[model samples]
Target: EIESIANHYGWQIIEQEIDKDHIHILIRYSPKWSILEIVRLLKQLTTYRMWQKHEVYLCRHFWKERTFWSDGYFSCSIGNVSKEIIQKYIQEQGR
Candidate 1:
């Protein structure tokens, strides 16, 4: 799902890692899209799809609220760092 979203917007997802409770994605996005917009799109679409596929199981945990991801997110630029280093870091998450 995330890959599809990235593809739709022409964002390059260099690497990604999904943990039980969170995800790490190393994505290269266009300057036209703000981080807020990207985060909103990801959480909104992924939450909707997840609910569609696993409503029964999700309802058990999120019965009181229709929330999947947390309200806050963490994002940062690679800055002067190497892309491969970040990709390796993302890949090693949750292991």
Candidate 2:
């Protein structure tokens, strides 16, 4: 799903890891998109798809909530770090 979203937006996801509680993604996005916008769109699109695909389970667990992702997100610029290093970190996050 993440890959599909990235592709749809013409962004490249170099690496990604989904841990039990969090996710790490190394993405190369266009300058037109801000970090906040990227995160918001991802969470929104994925949440809607997930809800549609797994409505019963989500409703059972989140009876009072309508959101799947938390309101907070962490994003960083690739200023000093190399892309390889970031990709390695994201790949290792699930280990």
Please write out the lDDT profile of model 2 over residues 44-86, one tens digit for every residue. Answer: 9999999999999999999997789988888888899998988
Structure candidate 2, residue pairs in collision: none
Predicted structure 1: lDDT: 0.93
Regions of model 2 farther than 4 Å from truth: none
1-95 in candidate 1: lDDT tens per residue?
99998999889888999999889999998899999999999999989999999999999999997778999999999999999999999989999
Worst 10 residues of 1 by lDDT: 64-73
Consecutive 10-residue window with the lowest summed lDDT within model 2 = 86-95
